[model samples]
Target: MTDLQQNYAHVYNNSVGFGRYPCLILIDFAQAYFDPDCPLYAEVDSALASALRLRKTAQTANIPIVLTKMTYDVAGVTGGRFFEKAKPLEAFLPGRATGEFAKGLVPQPTEIVVEKQYPSAFFGTSLASTLICLGCDSVLLTGLTTSGCVRASCVDAMSHGFRTIVVADACGDRHDAPHQANLFDMKAKYADVVSEAAALEHLATLVTRG
Candidate 1:
C-alpha cells in the first residue's frame, strides 16, 4: 500500500455495519449528469447500470427509496452562494430539461422525491425527517458525481445519525481521481463504501429476516 493508504489503514479505516432498517438514497441522477451533450455529463454508464440493479432489488425488498434532484428557481434565487460559485448549476434552472430525472431511472410513483438547490439533499429539504418517519436507521446511497453530490449527501447522512453506506460501484464522477479519492476518504471517515452486489445481498438478508 502507498504510505498515505497505509497511514489511513492503521488509523482511520474501519467498517460500519448496516443498521436494522435501511433506506436507499439515489442522489442527483438527473439528465444533466447523464446526457452526453450536456457539459455536466460524467460518463457514468457503469454506475447507472449498477444503480438500476440496486434499485430493482430495493424495490423488491420494499426498501424506502428517496430520489433527490437539484433544481433552482427560474431566477436562480434559491441556490445562493453555491449558484454563484458554480454557474454550471444553471443547467437545472426551473423547467430546464437537464433538471429532469434520466429516462428509465425516474423515481416510481411511490418513491419520495426531494428537490434541493444544494449538494446535500438534507441541507434544505425534508430528507432527514422523512427517513426518520420511515424508520430508516441506515442509508444506502447510489448516485452521480462521487466527489460532489454523493460525498456531500453521505457526510450529511452520517451527521443526521444514519449509518451511511456509499455504494461504490453505483456512484460515479466525471474523473477517476476525485471519484476514487473521495471514496477512500468517505470510507475512512464519513461512511462505509460497499459494492452494488454487497448492497443487494444485504437487502436479501433483510427480506429473509422478515
Candidate 2:
C-alpha cells in the first residue's frame, strides 16, 4: 500500500487510539449559519473569540487546520429534507456569502476547507482521509452549535481512532442547557471535553518541547 493508504488504514483500525500526529478541526462556523437569530444559534460569543485564538495558535504551531461549512445547492438540492424538518432559520444556499466561513475566523490559504451536508464531518466526506494524509492522529475540535455539529464531529473523530478533544468554551449552542448536556455526555462517553483555556495550556506544553 502507498504510505497514504497505510496511514488511512491505521486510522481506521485504531479508531480512538492516539497517533503521534495531531490536527485541528473547526466545525461549521459559517457566518449566516452561526447567527444568533438562527434556529440552531447558540450564544457562544466568548467561544467564537476563543476559537479564533485557537486557530491562530494552531497556525503558529504549524499544525494542520481543517474547517467545515454546511453548504447546499443554490436551488437547495441537498439538505432540502433538512430544511423541511429543521427549517433552519438560516440556510446555506450554494454560492452564497451566508454560507461562507465567518470573516473573523477565515481560513488561511494553506488551510483546508471541507464543505459538508451532514452533521458529522466524516459522513460521506473525506475528512478521515484528509486527516490521514496530513498525518493527523489527534484532532482539536472547535466550532458552533455545541450540542449539534461540534458534538457530532467529536464523536466521529473518536470513533475513527483519533484522539478527539473538544474545546468546551470554543463551541456554542443556542441555549445553555443543551450545550451543557452535550458537553457532559461527550466528556463521559465520546471525547475529552476541556475549556478553551485548558486546551490551549495543553497545546503550549506540546509547543514548548518543540
Candidate 3:
C-alpha cells in the first residue's frame, strides 16, 4: 500500500464503532448534474443508489430522515463567500431540477427537507433542534461532496452531541481524491466511517432491540 492508503487504513481502524443512533441525514444528491454545462455537476448514480438503500433502511428502522437542498434566493440574500465563488457554477438555482433531490432519492411523505445556505447543515439551521426533538442521539450521514458538506456536517453533528456515522459508500464528490481524504479525516476525529452495509446492520440492531 502507498503511504496514503496506509494512513487511511490507520484512520479506519481507529474509528469508533456505532451504537444506538436514531436519525439519518442525506446531503445534496440532487439532479443538478444532468446539465453538463454546469460546473458543480457530478455523476453520482452510485452514491445515489447507496443513499436510496440507506433511506429505505432508515425508514424501516423507524429513524427520522432529513434531506438537505442547497438553495439560492432570487435577490441573492444568502450568498456568502462560497456562494460568491459558486455563482459562476450556478447549478443549484432555486426551483430548478438541479436543485431538486436526485431521481430515486426523494424524501418520503414523513421525511423532512431542509434548505441550507451554508456548508454545514447544522450551522444556522434548525437541524440541532429537530434532531433533539426527535430524541436523536446519533446520526447516519449520507450525501454528496464528502470533502465539503459531508465533512462540515459530520463535525458539527459531533459537536452537537450526536454520535455521527458517515456512510462512506453513500457519499461522493466531484473528485475522488478529496472525497477519500475528507472521509479519512472525519473518521479519525469526528465520526464513525462505515460502509452502507455495516450501517444498515447497526441500525437494524437498534430497531430490533428498541
Candidate 4:
C-alpha cells in the first residue's frame, strides 16, 4: 500500500491468468550471467535454481520448453546499437565460453534453441512463429536479469497475443531496484507476475499432450 502502488491499484489489476496451452520460455541463462569473470554476472543463483525446478516440473508434465541465447556473427554487426552500447555482449561472441549455457542446464535434442542478438527473444527470431505452431496460447517465462531480457520477452509475449506469466522467483536482476520496479510495471501492464509456488499450481492444472 505504498503511495506508488496505491496510485495504480485498481486500474492495473486485471490478471491475464494462465492459459490452456502454455509454453515455458527460459531466456538467456547463459554462462555470461553466471561467471564471476564476466561483467554481466548478476549473482542471481536463487533465480536460476527456481527456474531449474520449474523446468523439471515442465519436463514431468510434458510441457514444451524453449531456450534463448545471445549469438552474433564475427563482426558483431547483427547486434547493432545494442552491441555497441553494451560491450558486455562481446562475451557472447561465437565460440566463446561465455556464450554457452550455464552449468547444470543443458538443452535436450528435442528442445528448441533460439539464438538472438537482442533482448526480446521474439525480435528477429522465430520464437513467435514457433509458439504459434505449437498452439501455445500462453507463455511461462523465466530467466536472468528481470529488468533486461526477462522484461523484454514478457512484453513481447503479450504483444504476440499470448497470455504471459513471469515467474518472479525464477527471474532476477543485478540490483533489486530495477528488478522490483520492472516487476511492478510488468504486472500492471504487460504480464502476470507470479510466484514460483503459484506458477507450480498453474502447471499442475495443465493437461499434457500425448
Clash count list over all predictions? 0, 7, 1, 0
Decoy 2 TM-score against native: 0.84
Candidate 3 displacement at residue 175 in angstroms: 1.4
> Which portions of model 2 miss their true places by more than 4 Å?
1-19, 33-41
TM-scores of all predicted structures: 0.97, 0.84, 0.90, 0.97
lDDT of 2 by residue, 81-164 (tens): 655666562457766566777768767899998988878888769999989887888998888788888888888988898888
- Stretches of candidate 1 exceeding 4 Å from the true structure: none
Which 10 residues in a row give candidate 1 its minimum summed lDDT?
Answer: 6-15
Which lDDT tens digits does candidate 1 get at residues 1-210? Answer: 788987877699778898888998888888898778788988888888888888888888888988898988888989999999998898899888988988788678999999998999899899999989888999999898899999999999999999999999999999999999999999999999998889999999877877
Instruction: Quote the lDDT for 79 in model 1.
Output: 95
Better of 2 and 3 by TM-score: 3
- Which lDDT values do the candidates have, in the order given? 0.89, 0.76, 0.81, 0.90
The number of the candidate with the highest lDDT is 4
RMSD of each: 1.0, 9.1, 2.2, 1.3
1 versus 2: better lDDT goes to = 1
Q: Return the TM-score for candidate 1, rounded to 2 decimals.
A: 0.97
Show the colliding residue pairs in model 3: 32-98
